[model samples]
Structures are given as structure tokens and as C-alpha cells.
Target chain A: MKTICIMCPVGCSLNVYEKNGEVIVEGNSCPRGEAYGKTEFVNPSRVVTTTKRSGAFSYSLKTDKPVPKTMIFKVMEKIKKTPLKELDVGDVFIKNILKTGANIIVTGKLTI
Target chain B: MSSFYDVIVIGGGPSGMQAAIEAKKEGAKVLILECNDSLGGILNQCIHNGFGLRQFKEELTGPEFAYKQYSEVKKLKIPSVFGAYVTKIEGEKITALVRGKEKEYFSKAIVLATGARERTAGEIKLAGDRGAGIYTAGTAQKMINYYGKLSGKRVVILGSGDIGLIMARRMTLEGAKVLKILEIMPSSSGLRRNIRQCVEDFEIPLEFSHTVTRVVGRERVKGVYYAEVDENLKPKLETEKFLECDCLLLSVGLIPENTLLSEVEKNIKKQIIVNEFRQTSIKNLFISGNSLHIHDLADNASEEGAIAGRSAALFARGALEELGEEYEISFSSAISYTVPQRVSGCGSFKIFFRAKQNFLRKKIVVRCEGEEIASKFCVGITSGEMQEIEVESGKVKGPLTVSIE
Candidate 1:
């Protein structure tokens, strides 16, 4: 498996291959790169950031943590289609969004 | 009521926030005057990752990066006023319209962190009818990434700048189809990683040496007509082709919003002229962030803000030690322009610059009085991104010049 780690500006190219039943990673600068490669090759997840319409304006949101890559669209649809009220900054508006156990919280204020 | 402070920072974005933090750290009464409802500036709408790498060494979103500085301002208990419209600068005093009332502010020193704005459709001079569905790249990003609304289904983006590329990906992620991105220059003005992830990964076509010469549509955009350009980037009318796109996103460029400092706004290649300490021609008045020069990363802007803040604080307290013998910094033919065109003979400071064209594996050298003060080997040097050089304290004297060989 080959992928680019979008973790930081370094953008290290990772080549993950299984050898002798053990997954080996190369071209990583730090430990985070190794962890990123292994997790990405196995169960990939990402912290999604998007906007939600509320009244006349919109509020920016992010998943509390990384969610399954396969469930990203579902999470985005659930967030976009849902009706939102005025939110304070850091408000956890949606609980268990996408049933992925990740909550959607307001990273930007709508009430301001 | 009119209030007084030791330092007044205009435009409460990342630069203003960081400036306030540094000034407050110097034990001076500071006040931040922001025109927007919030203090983060454009960072609020930039929700994507890849910020704060140079500062925190952590990948944080735009809002998160702004929050880091905002939290510091809160902890310092600095006074700030949002929705304050700055009128103009009168000598050392500042005046603004705050809370629907005109208020005057007195400050010993002022820091102008008033960021930049996007160049619109008119600025680019597209020969076409004025119609709807025309948006600046930043405006569209704010609409989709911040407002949660996709303006159009099929889009043709002009300019392959960072914002344009970012929106190409954002619009695609939100289900809006981005037809293609057009650029007048043969190369992109954005980071290489952005080109790889935002455009290449998504399979979005970025056509170089091409530009939209005209736009079609009246009430709303129906399509855009673009053409291949010559070496001067002038469109060749014979090679024009029309592509049907519902929306036209202009990712052309950004210009500094230095309205209050218009009196002394002597720009060096479209950027404010400043000294080593981020001080402009007026000693007490310092400039930082995008207002000084268009920085590729926000962390650089924050760092400039801190320098301006500290310098302003020192100037205000009359404790600023003079670094005698100021020398003008010059650049070679390969360099576009250098920031802080003036430098002090003593103390260490960083100077930022851009290349005139693209080069691979080039040697960047900085010389002071014919002595090589600093040199570095760079890979993939492009005109779009900024290059920096750090001047070591007391390394050399007199006029400084930087060149790429």
C-alpha cells in the first residue's frame, strides 16, 4: 500500500507492505507517520470539517474525532440535511452522528 | 466615550491577535480594534487542515489556529472591540465607528494588521457581460465551507491559486461538479502539495497557459470562454474555447487592505515598505501579516505580528534601543521582491522573498558587504511560494543583497 500522509506539511510518502505476516512501513520521518500508515492501511478514518446552515447564516463543524472513511459521506449528509438552531462555539449539536459514535460540534460560532 | 491605550491593533485577525499578545507580554495596555464580528479573520472560514505547522508543529484547521491565538488573548485579558469600523489615522491617534457610534481612541503606538482582500471579476478584466454566479474563490469557500451552501453545480474556476485549488476539492466533496481550473501562467501559484492533493488526487484538470477571456450569461453564468495566452499572459483570441459552467469562481489574487495607512503607503512591489522591526516609515506605526506581504502560510503572518507587537511596545515605552546604521536590502534579477527592504546592522532577523520563476535544485545566497552571510540549497523553487533567509546577529555590515544561483 502506498499513500501520502496529510498529517503535516512534510507530506511524507509512505509505502506499507506486509512481510512475513508483519506490516512494514518505510519513508516515514516520525512515529506518527508509522501509526498513520498502519491505521490507514487497515481502518482509515478522518476528522471531517464542514458547514451547517442555521437560520440566515451557517456554522462550521468538525467531528469530535476521526470517523470511518466509508461513513464520511453519511456524516456529511446527516450534518447538511439536519435543521440547526443558533449555536454557541464548541456546542455539541449532534450526538452519535452517523451512528459512528462521533459527535458533531460547532468549531465556529453562529450566535455571534 | 474615547479611550486611551498604549498600543492599538487594527483588524483583529491572526496578526492582530498575535500582535496584541506580544504587546501585552511587554506589560503595555493594548486594545484590538476589529471590523468583523469575530477576531479570526479569514481563518474562520478556512476549515481545512495543514495550519500551524511552523508554530505548533501540529496540523490544525484555520479556526483552530485562530483559536490558539484567541485563547492567548483571553488569558491575557486584553481589551478588544468587534464590529469597529476604522475611519482613519490622525497622527498617533486612531478613530473608529464602534457599536453604531463613532469613537476615538488614543494610542502611543499602533500596529496595522489589517489583512488583505480578494481581487474580484472586474479587477481581472474579463471581457464579458456582468452577470450572476460570479464569486471570488475565498467568497465561495466561505459559502461552502463556512455557510454550508453550494452556489452552483457545474463550475469553471479561474486561476490555480491555493484558494481556487482548495475550492475545487471542497466543491467536489460537497457534490458540486468542478469542470476545470484555468491559469494564465504556465505554472500554479499554490503549494505543490495542494496541487497533488486538491487537484491531482481528485483528478481535476488544471489547464496552464490558458485564461478566461470572456464570460457568457446575463442573469446567471451559463459558461466561460477561455484561450491560450502568449508569454506576456495575454489571451490569444484565435485559440479561444467556451466551456459551459454554471458558476465562475475567480481565484485570481489578493491585495493588501491598507486603507488607514494610505498617507504613508509607499508600496514596494504592491506591499507595504517596512524596516527590520516591522516598522514602517513612521516609527511608531508598524505593519504585519498579509498587509505587509502576501504570506504563503498563516504561521508566518503570526510571527510577523509578534515582531510588530514587540517593536511597538518598545517604541511606546521609549526603551527601544537603536541598532545604529540602517542599510537598504536589495535583491538580484532572479528575485521578485524582498520584504522589510530595510534592515539594521545588528541583531538577527528573517527576510522573506519570492523567486521570479521556477527552478530545481538552486543555491540561494544572501550577502552583506560582499560577505556571504547565509546560503542554502533549495529544491523546487517556484514564484508562487515564498523563500526566507535568516540574518545572523553581527555577521556582516552595510547594504545587503540576496540572490539565487
Candidate 2:
């Protein structure tokens, strides 16, 4: 698989070849790219955003935690359980909601 | 018929919103005129994180940051006219040519928060067919962030600025293959945090001292050629190569949006030359945000915006005094340009600028009337970080010069 390294401003064109589920990378100009290539092919994580309900108004608790790339769908599911009663904007909803120990702060608010 | 208002804000971005909130705190009736369909000027479309770190003391996305300010503006009963396009601002009057399909209205003190627009591909001529695949990084980001549209499967981003670096990561996350980011300079122009969070973390290749010599494409985009540059920025031979690609995203730079201000004052290279209070050469009318000066972060813009707001209020109240003679800050070792080429007779002020290059340890000195008044040391200072120094406004009585040691 071919990818671009997003480590520095130098978006290096990287070549990743996976054999036996092990990732080998090349064409990267720095060591950071090697680590990114390994994690990208193995486990991908991302910072996710979504909304939580509380009464008629919906409060958004956008997570600042970088969750596993595979768990984005499941994390969204778990986020649905938390209600936004009395929640305000910029309010951190779940402290480590995904058990990633990454604090998720409220990013948006939907009100009438 | 004309309605009297205590304060009127033009834009709804973080700065404009903050200015409106501040002005309203003075117990004055405030109104915000937003040209866009909704509030939040550029912040509405900027879907990435890295905002409100200093002001809110927490990392917030652009929309999230905008939402916090919007909620305040909404709760404070800060009336806003959405889809209200402002046309002119002269003296104490502002003319906004508004139209919502046959309905037209005029409103009058304009904040002039109309933010700057991105310089398009047409301005920077890249050798190749001006095709569909070419786009500014901001445009591509709007497509993906708002409309959920992918620019292309393969891409080559030019200019190692923040937007380009962030888009490199964004495109990769969306399953698009980013070929590389070619920068004309020896070092990247983006922030260190962005370089770490967006580029380095994502394993994106950032080629320094390299530039796109030629772009190869017929209708869409086929590929691009890169080459190294010398000290004078002349393209060096024997270092040219081609990569296959379908898209080219240019994150060149932003020019201040000063179309309406043009009728009042002339432009010096497309930037409105303003006084200490951010008042353009013309009196009463003020410019802030990206319109006054291109800032590194929204934080600086907000700070300047609030000052402009206060100054506008003071002007409206006829409390403004004549500006003193201009004082210039000269760079010697590694200092870049400083704003407010002339300092007014104020008490306390902070100067903002960037370093010429990277340095481990350095001393910055401020000299006025051939006497050094302020001296400070720094650590790990790089061109990536904008340097802001606060000095007692009373320290410098006459013209001053700044030098780095």
C-alpha cells in the first residue's frame, strides 16, 4: 500500500508493503514516518466529534481523545448513552469516555 | 429612517463576536451584521482543531470555538442580520446593500470585520493546464469538512503552510493518497504544533528547499515535477523528479479582505495601511482581524479586534486624540517585520513579530532615542512561532529601533 506521511510539513510520499500482517515502510525522509506507517497499517485512531442528548436541547461533547481507528464506530455508540442535561458549551462530557483516559470536551451545542 | 445603535459589528468570527460581546458589556445596544448565511465568518467552514487554546485555555475546533462565541452573542440578545452584505463605510455612516430575493434594506457605525479571502490559483501561476484538480487547500477543506466530498484519490500539495499540512493529514484520513508537500523555502512556515500534530504524526513527507518547477496535466492533473532551490531561490538543476498524481492543493497565503475599505484608503500591496488604533488612513473607519494584518492565530486577531472595537467606541464618543509622530522598529540580526510601524503615545503595548530563522538562545533588545530600555531572553525560538513582547509603553518616549542579539 502507498501512503503519504503526515508527520511534518514535508508530506513525504511513503510506500508501505504489508506481508504476513506486518507493515514495512520506505521512501519516508524521517523516523516519525516509520512509526506512523506501522500504526496506520496496524491500528488507526482518530479524534471524533458527536452530540449527546439531554431533554429537548442536544449538547455536543466533542472528544479531544484520539481513539483507535477501528473503535470510531463503537465510540460513537457509547457516546449516545451520555445525556446532556444541564450541559453547556465547552463542557467536558466524558472523562475518558472510551477508557482511553483522554478527556472529551463539549464542542458544540444544539438548542431551540 | 435611521436607527441609533451603541455598537455595530460587521463580522461574526471569533474576533468580531468577541468585540461585540466586549462592546455590549459597556451597556450599549450592539448589532452584528454577517455577510455569510450564518454567523462565524471563516471559522464556520474550518472544521479542524487547534483554536481557543489561549482564550478558552482548551483545545477547540473552529466550529466549536465559533459556537461558544455565537451562543454568547445569541444569549446577550446581540441582534444579527444574517445574509446582510455590507457595501460601504464612510465617516460615521455604513451602507450595506442587502438583498434576499427582491427585499432590500440599508443599515448604518460599521465594524468592518469583513475577514480576508484566500489567494486563488489564478494569482499564483503554476505552469500547467488550469484544470479541475487544482484547488486551494481551504477550498478542498470546505469540500471535505462541510460537504463530505473527497478532492481526489492521489494528491500533491504545494507550500508547506498549516492549511496544506493539515489537509495532507485530512486527505489521508479520508483514504486519499497524498504524494508529498513541496515547500519553496528551506524551512516550513507553519507552527511547530501543527508540524507535530498534522504532518509528523501522520508520516507526511515535507520536502524543504524544494518547489514545484512544472505541473504536468492536460485536462485534469497527471503529475508534478519538483526541484531544489539555491540561496537566491533560483531553481537548481540536477534535482528534478516527477510524481504521478491527480490533484494539486495550494496553501499559498491569505490577503486581507479590504474591498469596501478600498473606497476610503488606497492599498500598499493589497494591505490597508492603518494607524496605531487600526484606523485606516481615513478617520473613524477602523480595520482589524485579517483585514488589518495577517496574524498567525485567531488569538492575535481577537486581541486586535477587541482593541479596534474599543477604539471605534472611543472614536464614536469623540474621545480619540491625535496620533503622535511615527516610530519605526528596525531589525538587525534575525527579527522579521513588526506591526504599527509607528507607536502612538500610549502607556503599555505589546509588539508582535517573527524571527528570521531558528535559534536555541537569543536576546531581544528595544532601543529608543539611542538608549536600550527593554531586553529579554528567549529559548527554542523558531520562525514557526510568532514572538510577542510586552514593554512599558512609557519606556520609549521617542522613535525606537529593535535588534536581536
Candidate 3:
């Protein structure tokens, strides 16, 4: 498994190899890199955004923070229930929606 | 006649001072031409904390941060002429024309660090009269913090940028009543922490998606008409409303000072374009700081100044190669723009970019010819705070594309 650690400006190339149900990683200089690799490889999570049926049009809603590396697909299911109002870019959906108490923020502008 | 040095730096602001210091460290004699009587640029007027957090690891006010750099210049003993306005720079030798009360000087390698100017109310074409109460946020800050004069008793800030927000808090602390902060965009353009501290903590009402449509007053500002924007950012008719305020502060934006560049007039579109090395089209000329482009923070400007300074020194030593034509820089994905459009492919390079908007745990993948070369993720990136990615030599081979995802 391999991933890029988006911790800061020093984007180190990260490579993760697994053996005997265990993972070993190399090439990252930061502790965040190691944590990202292990979490991403084991349960891959991401912040997700989707549109919900609103009164006039679609309302784009998203989790305020990153979720379990594996729950990205399931969270999208939950987000489909909330209709996104005509929100501008960078609007917060929730302070902490991950349930784990981590904050996920919006990444793009709402075109509609 | 004007005298010449190896490098001539314009503007004695932090960027200009730092550039001169860096050039001196590289064994190059440098001259800094400052237009003001003092060396500190905007920092002299900005007396707030939240500076020197990244650079010094300790928080300091703007003036204190500037004094540290000023002391470094003194230690290095870099030569500079204060109260000197650089009128122009010309030719292969990079002769610069500057005027002072008594004398003028010319130099070899010219560096434009003229900094930037605040965008006035007239430029934005806001429907209003030339009232006495309207002022740019920076001007208001200078008046209050530098001259100890209050422009108005009550204020309605028209922009939510760092300066405006800080002014809001400053005014609140000074016993002035803040009517509201009208921001056109939905999100504050200032740092997140600033929004928390200045607006949220101070109990200032920050109205997003709102803009001032017209100003109402003849002799002085009596009120301002504002409204919320629709999905297309058109002011919603139903949302129109008027608020009473004596002062209107425009924190809209800042424009780079490029009048001197036009005197010598080189190939440029919006601003004087430079390559990754911070070198301009002319061989012996360089530009950095606000003169090159607007940066969010002062520390970033200092870093750019260092790069331009060091590169100018290399050019003076005659060890620098002609910046190659093969490697060009392009911005895509989530980047607003990248400085130094081309890297000479000769040395380690630093690339600076501003995100189009905020990001959440996204990776910035640097690609060459559609192949991934380097990628890094940021916990979050914003348009206000620039993100700098340094690429060592050999990692980049061809043209580069940065995508944030």
C-alpha cells in the first residue's frame, strides 16, 4: 500500500508494504505519514460530499471531518438524506460529523 | 550621477530588508532603496500579535518582528538609502534612478520590492459618493494604530479579510461601536483562527453572502445599503436593507505597485512575471515580495525575498546559468497560481501556491507529463495562507502540474 501524506508542505513519497498480516512503511519523515498509511490501508476513510433533494434544488452536504477509512461509502448513504441548500463554498456542514469527534470541512464551491 | 552596487533592492520593507541581508550573506554588496523615512513597511503600522509564529516559533507584534530583521541588517552592515524613491531601472547593467533630498544612486542588479498599495473605494466602483467617512481598512489601521486618531465612532466594515477583521476587534477594544461586517463571500477570507478570535470571540456580527450595494450620505457617511447574494452572487432584491453607520471601511483588496516596472516596460501581462528563481525577464533584474505578487503573510514574503536575494547574488557571481526553456510551470486543480513560472532546472527550487479554497485532508500531487512525481497532503489549506512545497533537484524532470485532491 502507498499514500501521500498531506500533513504539510514537505510531501514525502510514502510506501507501505504488508507481511504476515502486519504493515511496514518507509520513505516518510513525519509521524503523521506513518499514522496516515496504517489507517488508510487498514480502514481507508475519506471526507465525502453529496447532494440532497431540497425545496428548490440540490443542497450539498458533507461530513465536517474525515471518517473511518472504510466508512466513506456508508457515510455517503447517510448524507443523501440531508438536502443541501444553496450554500457557498467553504460552508461548514457539521462541526464534528465523524461521530469519532473529528471535524471534516467542505472542499469545493457550490455551483448551483 | 548615480552610484552602482552588485544588487539594488527597492522598498525597505521586511521583504526588501531581508533580500538585502541575504544578498550580503552571499558576498554581494547590496543597496536597499526605501521610499519611507523608516525601514519598516506595513509592519510599522501593524502593532498586533500573531506575527513571527512560523518564522520565530514565538509570537511577536509586527513592529517587533520587523525590528528583528532590521537588527540583522545592521549586523550584516548592508548599505541602504532611506527616504529614497526608486524612479526606474534600465539596461544590461541594471542602472536604477532614485531621488532623495540630497543625492541619488544607481546600482547593477536591481530588485523591485516596492510592496503593494491598498485598493481604494473608487476602483471597486461601489455606488457611493466621495464621502469623508469611507476609508480603506489599511488606511484606517494606519490612522488609528500609527497616528492615534479615530476616524469614526461607529463603523460598518465592508470586507472580512484579516485586516478588516483585526480592525473590527481593534475598534471594539477602543470603544467604537461596530454595526456589522458585510462580507460578499460566504466564508471569511481571513485565517480561521482570526475568524474565531476577531469575529466570534469579540461578538462582532459577520454577515456572509452580503455586500454593500450603495452608500448613503452627502457630506459624511450616514448609512450603507447592503443585501445578501443569491446563488449566482447577484444581490438578492428581497434581502436589501440599510444600516446606519458613520464610518465605512473597505478591506476589499491590495494591488501590487508596478509603476516603475512600466517605465522600463518589459513583457508582462497583469504583473511583472518571473520564473521559479524569482528572476524577471531581464538578466540583471529580480522582483519579490508584494511587488512580485500578493502574499497572505509577511513570513512568506520574507522567504520570497531571500530566494530573490540569493539568486541575485548568484547572478552577480556569474556562476548562474541561463534559466532553461524546457521546464515551464503551470497551475491546475486547486491552485490559484504559482510563482516563478519556470525553474531553470539548475538548483533546488521552492514553489508557492494558494489554494482555490479550503481543503480537508487532501493531497497535493505534483506530476510531470501526467506521471506522479511528488505528492503531499495538508491537514487543511486555505486561500489566505499560502502553502509552499520545496522540490529538490532531480525529482522534477519535465513540466510540472500540481493537483490537490
Report each candidate's C-alpha RMSD, comma-separated, in the order given.
2.7, 7.8, 15.5
- TM-score for model 2? 0.79
Q: How much does candidate 3 score in TM-score?
A: 0.75
Give the better candidate number (1 or 3) by DockQ: 1
Point out the higher-scoring one by TM-score: 2 or 3. 2
lDDT of 2 at A80: 58
* Candidate 1 lDDT for residue B262: 75
DockQ of candidate model 2: 0.11
List model 3 lDDT by residue over B19-56, tens digit each.
89899999988878776766768876665555675677
Question: What's the DockQ for every one of the candidates?
Answer: 0.42, 0.11, 0.02
**Candidate 3 runs further than 4 Å off:** A1-112, B92-104, B263-269
Q: Per-residue lDDT tens digits of candidate 1, residues B180-239?
A: 999998888887667766787678989999999889999899999999999998889999
Which prediction has the highest DockQ against the true structure?
1
Write one digit per residue (lDDT tens) for candidate 2, span B305-360. Answer: 77767776666666665555656555565776665555764667766667888777
lDDT, candidate 1, A32-96, per-residue tens: 88987887878877777787767766677888877887787788888878888877777898998
What lDDT score goes with residue B141 in model 1? 87
Q: Say which docking band candidate 2 falls in.
A: incorrect
Per-prediction interface RMSD in Å = 2.5, 7.0, 19.1
TM-score of chain A of 3: 0.52
